[model samples]
Target: MGNTLKSVYDAKDNLKDYHVRAALQEDKGKGTTLMSWGLQDFTEKGDHYISVISGLVVRYGKGNSQIDETYIVKLSAPQVTKALRDMVAQGNKKEILFYRELLPAMNSELKKVGLNPLLTPQCLYANQDSENSVLILRDLCSRNFRKFPGKSCLDISHTRLILQELARFHSSSLLLKAAQGPQFVAKYDFLDKEWYNVTEDAIAFFITLFDGNIENGVAILKVLEGDKRTIRWLQTIKHNVYKILEEMMKERHSLHHCVARGLSGYDEYGNPIEAILLDFQIVRRASLVTDLHLLLNISVSGTDRKNNLENFLQLYYSSFKQVFDAAGLQVPFQFHELFQEYENKIMFGTLWALAVIPMIVSGGEPSEWASSHHRAASEEATGKQRESIDSKISSKHGELRARFLPIFDELIDQGIIH
Candidate 1:
């Protein structure tokens, strides 16, 4: 092998111990002799930028036959800046902590209540090395898990499955807190801060990023000839963005769940039958509607969201209530209360759409927003960054308009803005 290829192979070999340990866990008490293993890049372009993801396949012999097991491994990306690397490392640390400690404890509570534990990728092995963190998880692809094919927005079938899973996840938190008391949940309060850590050094970068997103969103609005009043409302949100962000991030509710950053899984007919939530990097104590707002606005199509939002809410509530009822516990909030809270939290949805929809429609890479060292340094650099963002928005102008106009009109119809 060439020097670079040899180094990569050497690194994969070094991870053999973790692969062996994961194999033992999968094999249960049955002794299996390890035969060989291989590693391959597992992530698609634009799927992630923070970490290098690989598939680790290990072969084991049992009698005259052999079986192969696969694991999804994550390692910190080497090409990014130290600040970005540190940020990803922190996220990995939290995910490891969540899977190893908090999730099992919560699952124990679920067991007592006779509800199946929330389905997530099983962590086979993990470490939180500041620079070279590694996380090994059972490959969900073996179970037919995959992201929505292509850049298609989630349809009603897909949204239904996600809502069901999200409801169970949220309800589990409520049950756990009730059984173990707030003190149990309080032990992990540090998670709330880690979700979007804005270190003093990176504050200027985030400010620029946030401001740029809002500007692009407004630009899209004007391009679409969006309501004049709605434009004024968004401008107002931009002016008071910090306070609004703070309020949204505050611990406003008692029940907090493991809100997934994304989900993947599907059945044979190209329809979504099951979904497994991925990435527990931020399990915050926030209103359920906050998470609901994010998922609906970002992943689901605006047409689906506008037409079936109420049905979605009701599905979530019924599913949430079903778990409590099965466990002989009362739901803490009623349907009307959830509906009202969801409306009150409309700005959360608006913010998420503004921040994420443009990127999705434009096929923007994470680095464009994340590589902020230059962008935050001076007025000239900031202007260049804005110009870059404008180019991205314009490249997909038609898609952005189609994706956003429904959301903005829905907000207006609800009297949420304007």
Candidate 2:
């Protein structure tokens, strides 16, 4: 394993083969050689607050013909807190494990069953160094894959592609486990831990952040002139958040994967045709239902989620079952059981609305949660007021209100919160 980026590339025969082929297109037998390579920043400010991204651009040529290729390098941000930097390092290492070990093994199982491999960018290079960890990957953006816009609600077509991708990822785990027994996944034991290792210090931080969001939600509800009953229900939900979160994070189901965030490709008419899930930093072995709740509650618009959640579940299950059917294996659970699981997980949805939606609607960078004010707030016990939190929601009350009103209405209508 090479530590330097250039050494990694130089060691890759296939990469050289690719450049050699491209260079040879100009002249059938002319000699080809690598010319030069350089590095450049790859992401804009706020695109990724926890990690730094850059491109390693390589130029290779043969006799008047040249090709430039770029690979992305992701490293932990040096400027963040030690706690966050540690989490980032853990996530980067986990992702390296996903691409370098997990995905390849999972894809091999899928290949054995004659299914197409799960869609993911290729890992060109990876190192798991605790502080200076890095990954060099084939740049998905070069292939027209783009991050799904975070602020807007995703429509059904976009949502459909995402669910399909999720099904494939989850089913891959199932097929591999079935083929090799449950002990197979036990090797990657880190997937079974909670995403955040909740130490005593971390517990206080998580609860305070949870409370800050709960308070922000209460303010958003009041600003919307929300019904008193609904406001009270949100307050009650606040109290039970940590307990419910603990429950939700438990490993109740065997086939779990990362929370799927869309990195979509569009056709000429500008409609979504493909989705590739990204960000395996928090991959866990919890119920797949939580993935559903997280995506639908946070990523999809409240109206879209309300209108199509059942349809979305059916679509996901069918895609999931189709993989098993094609592989000549039994699906672990029936659709009715899946539906029940979704119903049982609505509390997760409510929690997402309270704790995660503000950041989405307020359009605040996730790094803001690390600000001095919020950090102070996170240290306090639950129920303490954080003016910074209130100001954030107050500044964006209209967007926050619009986003939450329908979500809360749907939750209340289903009798999940009240």
Candidate 3:
């Protein structure tokens, strides 16, 4: 162990004494975190990292624009009252295993990749003594990310950036698993059928919430509710939706109709200088591309332009190229091959957009799903901060559409959709 830095502050105060000496990255106030999102089963809505059971609040801060010298962490009271261990004890093994194995193991891997351990701050802390397991994170802003915080139509450039990052992150993990073999295997247990059962239920709940453009909305709903349908065409919906999710829970795993062309070249610095990953809560043995597709669709739904789709693919291909080369592996998969394989996967992204757009797009005002994250974000996201989220989304409407449509068309061209 190394010497700990000393600062006079309460364990739960947001003053200082929060730097992780080993973290390879630091936040300069890059992004914002909201507490609620519809109905999260784990229920982190009103508190940034609340333990529903523990009722103890662990306050952490990060900025993409600042280094450790300005970093802060605090310990505080919980927004809700629940026992952390009590909930853990009642939860199924896979949920527990996610926190116990995958989260910690993935954090360790991020550090190995020479980045901050908590790449996305999903949950990367464990203070067993105080019975407070929370996160102390380096913000996602450190990278030039295009994770359009609020309602973004889909900027081609931003979409591409996200795709590239996913490609890099996914392939990077694949390379690590390839290299580490048993060690990596030992760290992650396969998410079993039970996990899928839980996810299916959660997704079903969201599908019921779709209230968009009526005909389109109904079409989306019909697809979401196609579980028991025996129709042949419905099979396409089932295959595109449920089947993919099932396979994802099991293991490998998009694109659009816009017919996006791979750019001749891209910003080299945009490549994986280092890996920054997301959603450890769902980090099962899956095609990392599936996650990328889901997020991209969720992010850019209804945006007219599809080159954003092409841009997204480029992001994936380029980021992946960078990481594979750095890992000293000959980049084996061509970008087009991976794109073709993932074409249908884009529907998941659209599905996500259906659910998330209503909640996050407006920026400051409360939407249908606001209560989910609003109560939780009070600890970190102020009203002013939330208002600013709109600005991030507002400035990019044209660009987002320009970039998003091509991705959609590309998916259609690949014959990934019926």
Provide the overall lDDT of each model, using Cα atoms, as 2-decimal numbers. Answer: 0.67, 0.66, 0.38
What's model 3's lDDT at 306?
A: 43
Give TM per candidate.
Answer: 0.85, 0.82, 0.50
* lDDT comparing candidate 1 with the true structure: 0.67
Model 1 clashing-pair count:
0
lDDT of 3 by residue, 1-418 (tens): 0011121211233212332321222332324222211111211222122122111222333443322221212222222212322222222243335545655554455555565343333333322223233334333333343223334444454455446555544665566567567676565544422322344433432232232211222333233332222223333453145454454434343111110111112235654333233323234555555666556555555452343556666667777677656556677678787776556455555544434443343332222232222123253543443444345445644443443333434444555433
Better of 2 and 3 by TM-score: 2
lDDT at position 41, candidate 2 = 61
Positional deviation of residue 364's Cα in model 2 after best superposition, in angstroms: 2.2
Q: Give the C-alpha miss distance for residue 391 in model 3, angstroms.
A: 23
Runs with alpha carbons beyond 4 Å of true place in candidate 3: 1-124, 127-133, 139-148, 190-216, 219-244, 247-279, 301-305, 362-418
Pairs with backbone N, CA or C atoms under 3 Å apart (clashes), candidate 1: none
Top-TM-score candidate index: 1
Model 1 segments beyond 4 Å from truth? Answer: 1-36, 61-66, 202-204, 222-232, 254-268, 369-371, 377-383, 414-416
Q: Per-residue lDDT for 1-418 in model 2, tens only?
A: 0011222232232233343334333333446566776556634334454455566676767678887777666665553444454555566667777777678878998898788888876666666654555666676777677777766677789889989888888888877667777677687776765434534444554565576567666766776688777788867766567887888767556545555344788777777788987667776677888888888887777778877878999999999988988889888899999988887777777776676666666555554433422255343522244445566666776666556777778767887656
